[model samples]
Target chain A: MSRLSGTGLTLAYDKRVIAEQLSVEIPDGSFTVIIGPNACGKSTLLRALSRLLKPAAGTVLLDGGDVHSLPTRTVARTLGLLPQSSTAPDGITVAELVARGRYPHQGLLRRWSERDEQVVTESMAATGVGDLADRNVDELSGGQRQRVWIAMALAQQTPLLLLDEPTTYLDIAHQIEVLDLCAELHERQGRTLVAVLHDLNHAARYATHLIAMRDGKVARSGPPGEVLTAALVEEVFGLPCRVIDDPETGTPLVVPAARRKTSVQAEV
Target chain B: MSKVMVIRPRAVVIGAGALLAMTAVAVLTLGTGDFPIAPADVVKTLAGQGNAAQTFIINELRLPRVVTAILVGMALAAGGAVFQSITRNPLGSPDILGITSGAGAAALAVVILGGSSTALSLAAITGGIGTALLIQLIGGRRGLQGYRFILIGVGMTAILNGIMGWLLTKGVQMENARALLWLAGSFDGRGWEEALPLLGVLIVTIPILAVVCGPGLRMLEMGDDVAAGLGVPVKRLRNGALLVASLVVACAAAAAGPVNFVALIAPNIARRVTRAPGPNLLPSMAIGALLTVAADWLAMHSGYPLPVGVVTGGLGGAYLVWLLISERKAGRI
Candidate 1:
């Protein structure tokens, strides 16, 4: 089993520090979701773990080896990342965009191979973008575009995958659709998955391992049923809310407290 | 055997056709200059069998000019394609990024300071790299994102153009005429001395671009974070690509004095015509060669006898206006 861990990380962008001495361990073959409010450093942690943003101190370890010290292509072969925002080049076909994921496996003289084509096709098929292979990526809908981007990441064929806010900019149905795809990829493909999601309910429902963060620190890290509580919700989000079992999956569902009637009457 | 080649049939066909057109233009350019040698004589002279007059005309007088035009066009177009790919915008050519103007400014300084042509060429290269570094610094760590890079480049170009104008105003008649002709990017009186520097740069840089950097540009088109995630050394690759692009543009500027609009328009034309998903480096170079050769031919034979840069500049300016309106409509501006 491959291990992905970030230990004693001190993260900063320029002089502004975001996290100090932060450590995280992703459970193998589990779908881990990090949930936090905006500016809480959830995405920043993901970036560090995926080697997008180097930690100021400490290291991200993959299989007990420092990710930064290893050859980038080797690390990339073991891990894949789908960032929060990916802009599709103008007039690029869906197939072409997905094929770019094979960069790590290619070289100046080694070039594209049959294995690359096969993997790209399978990835597109898995993400349900096979039908749109010839269509321009810029012409796709938001949901379709997101799926294509995921397809590109999947084409890397890494054992571990990290996604940042993968469900953002999607409506309720599309959000569920993408989350469902991620769940399927985790459960069926048996790959380790880590994602930073904004919605607590979606994270609770889809995440096998959930990590709730507040102010760049982990508030709780455990199974959703064990970690998600009304008290913790109030503590992290500063919202008075009830945590209950979801009807469909029995995961935690949050319902915020209603406004006081006295305050409304006073307004009147 | 492992599969090592990815072929684009459309680009190949388009490139071949462009090459054929360029060859025809080259023959016409050689045969019609000054004394009017026949096309057969030009071909025979190229094959080392023409009479002294035909040989001298084709080999000495006309061949160098045609070669300079083709090489400069190819270099500019290739550089433009690389810049546009790195920036992920069709408008981000070397001309727009202030590279050509930087080279022109340095070349003008050389001329005004009474330096030799060798000094001018070397200074032009140095100027391009320096200006590109300045733009990169001003654009900050975001590299060429949004309109920031273009805006910074425009500011740099304005400053360089001011210096060039001042230099022109300060020079005497003979020197001013020479400087003015160079600024207008004429192919007249250009010989092997000018062609050699550009040829050497192209020989070294073009292979690096086409074989190694070109493929990585596809990943770059997906944004920096994603490109980094895909195992591309984004900063290193971006910097290297920028350096190569700057050098190529500088060499072209040194050879042909800031030939306007070839770098700006060639890549876009190649992209539209070939419709390739990745960077159209080769096709763009071919298109650039054709456009420059055709423009030079028109410049020589158009009765009014304008500089080659005038035609490209006028046409490119019109295209720029159309592009701005279209981009505005598309909400990209």
Candidate 2:
């Protein structure tokens, strides 16, 4: 499997520096989730790693070569990214949308082939969107639409997939549904999955490799059991919380500590 | 869980059907003029074997006008489709982008300032390109997203219209009247001098457009970030589409004097008719051709002999209003 890593990277947008001298390696065949507070540069780091945002310094390497120096379509054939939000074109069917992911593999003379058809079919089946293949994307519910989007990413047939805040606008149930799908894709297929997630507890529950970020730096990086703790949660999020085992999964679950009233405030 | 990727049959049918309709419309319109000739004679003369009167009517009088309508329809519709798909807004057409108005302003200036047909064509093309480049420089850094680009385009259009109004009022009566007829988009005196150059530009543009529409436009509908991730050279694709669209609009406006609403309405009409998922470039072009030819026929045959632009503007404005109401009802706005 090709290894993906970024070393000694300086990430920036225009003039404002987001992260300086940041280095990280994504472990092979693991569900790696990066968690951070709002504007902590988690998404920025993901963007750099995915080659959506070029680093101000250092290199993003796929295998041994510099990713930026590689042919963009070649890099795309290896790594696929699902952005947070993408609007469906009017009246587009799920199959047609997913078929677009085959673009990187297609050449000018070689348009859609039989293999493209098979891959698209397999991707829809894998994402459990086969039944919705003929349905217009706008008619589907939010969770279904997200799945269709993921199916499109899967249709790219890349081994390494990165998602930036895949569960952002989704409600609790839908969030869990998407995470469950991601976990299944990782564990079943042995593909490297990197996602930037907002909820710490959800990240701990789903991610095999957890990266906790604070102030443009990785505060903790390890397995969920080793890295997630009450003290770390308090330090990272500035919220006093107790970390306990999840009843169903035995992963770390954070419970916020209740605020106590002082004597003067209580009297008033 | 068995599913297959399939091409849309409806779109193919619609495309072929529109082409057939355009052929019929073109032939019919070619035959309906001051000295009316039969459709048989129109085709016979087009094939370079006809009587002297038939040859004169087809070759000298009606052929260029028909050819101009066809080319303008093609350019504006295809250009509109490109703009709409890139901007991801149904209302995002060359007319909305201030391109047509800019061309109109330049063409008017050329008319008043005393220029040849070729000079006027060249100036109009430059003006459209200038306006498009200005829009790109100002609000296009982020790509054509949200209201900013459209708003800026509207402002520019207003300013250009203001300039055009000033030019018309300050100019002499004969020139002003001639400018007004041009602004209303007449095919009354258009000839091979205009049609030949536009055909040359189209010969280059249409193939490039066909090549890009598949991957470039398909990726674009997925949004810029996803498009980039899919290995589409996003900036290059966008710039290419913009250039092609701008050039076509310039060429069409130069030929037909900024005929209103065909660019704005044809792409949307094609989409609705074909029910295609992505950008309907070919279908839109066909629809544009048909709409323009049909409108020209109506304008000439309307007893008072109105300009083609008047008919298109009136019909297209009504269509726009209907679209607004429908979109609002569907909660798209």
Candidate 3:
């Protein structure tokens, strides 16, 4: 297990500036949800923090050491990422697909040990895709397939997991199921997670801490109730919203007021 | 011997078995040439018990062609498997990048210029690797899209083919009938001189690819973005794979005069047989070796003698069609 902290991250894509002079301390062992409308740099922030994108200025420090300076396999051993829409080799079984995650751990002479097997088996079991271990990954339904992919990321056995839109392709039921699995993994493994989620309510319910982004800047960030207010949602999402409390989780719930017809706005 | 012969698949097991049977045919071919040795005498000669005449004929005449076919076959199949997986295009081969045409054209130049046989082989190998490198350069750094790579390769093939056709028109060059057949891609008249170089090259090259390309091949399969994210140097891996594939093609083409179709078929056959998604190298090499030997044997011993290339090209073309039809039938296309 490992913990990551420290930042002074200024990230940009080529010449198009995104985040500038950004710094934040991510506390260890917490579920952090980054939520914003598309193109607000939420995903870009995650990419920078995970060392997938180099900061134009500043550094991302993992456990008091520079993340980029660390050996790739060592960083991989500590942190795992499930990028949005990863393509697996077609026709590969779920078990074989999961087996690939052990690549960083296994070297030429030290390949495929019992520990690798146990990790993959336990991951498939923990992610609730144990039965799908033998099934062709491509043949399973969207939600089942997503879990299989999570099992692959889990098999890395990293203490920190980052997911970019894990619920992108799933239906409502499947989205909840996928997030529920993420929540379950967080609870069982005591791993810190940072995910870029599209659904605000889901983010509020699942995230212990929430960061809202607007136009490549952190608009607000704190406990979900404080950050996801009606005024903040309207300002960040350009949507008028009413806030309510969830009966199940006691998280702030956002209800969109209504689609504003341009003609009605003109009348107003 | 362990009784537990792990059954991989019927097609793979039987396919390899058929290839071994083809090796016998190649040996039989050796003994049947002029100054022929009888089958029993060949066995005796191999065992160091035959008469002098039997020993000379068996040792001198037959072994080279058989060995040549086996080595070239293994090389082509290995090349095919790597090419297909790295490109993630099942239809891909190093030949698709026009390395074969470059080798053939170089060989053609040497033969027409009356260069020694060794010079022709050397030229073919040099030409093949050079052409493969050129293509990789064009597709290097910021990688070329799959369709763009294929387009460039097709253009390269067309240019090399034109060069070959143009060179032949330069003089009143009267080619021997055997030479003409060889140009069409044959293993007919080849002997030990040809097989030896191919075998030496394969012994060095195949194991290198197996070891070095093992990790890089997986990186290639994961697509460049993810592979790079995983700390693989993408362009470097790409270059390494393409280089190995080109060398394999060059050695095979130089030895066997560009035996057609096996590089295109072996990997697919191996993949289908194993039911594994990524390219299965060992199986591909086995299938490639089997296909070439079987095609060569069938060509020599069929209803009448034909160049091995003609048989391979014809069979390979039909296999392509059958594959297309089957995929279409299964709605996989």
Residue-pair clashes per prediction, in order, are 0, 0, 0
For candidate 3, what is the DockQ-based docking class? acceptable
Q: Quick one: best TM-score, which candidate?
A: 1
Q: Residue by residue across B74-137, what tens digits does model 2's lDDT show?
A: 8999899888888888888889889999999998999898788788889889999888888899
lDDT of every predicted structure (CA atoms): 0.89, 0.88, 0.77
What ranges in model 3 sit over 4 Å off? A1-26, A48-60, A63-69, A261-268, B1-19, B31-44, B110-115, B140-146, B171-182, B219-234, B302-305, B325-333
User: How large a fraction of the reference contact set does each model reproduce?
Assistant: 0.61, 0.70, 0.20
Q: After superposition, how far is residue A65 of candidate 2 from its true place, in Å?
A: 3.4
Each model's TM-score? 0.96, 0.95, 0.87
Which lDDT tens digits does candidate 3 get at residues A66-122? 887887767777788787746777667787777777766866578666778788888
Top candidate, metric lDDT = 1
Residue B205 lDDT, candidate 2, scale 0-100:
91
Clashing pairs in 1: none
Error of 3 at B37 (Å): 5.7
Q: Which stretches of candidate 1 lie over 4 Å from their true place?
A: A262-268, B1-5
lDDT of 3 by residue, B217-270 (tens): 665575654454444556666788778788888889988888887888988888
Docking class of 2: medium
lDDT score, candidate 2: 0.88
Docking class of 1: medium
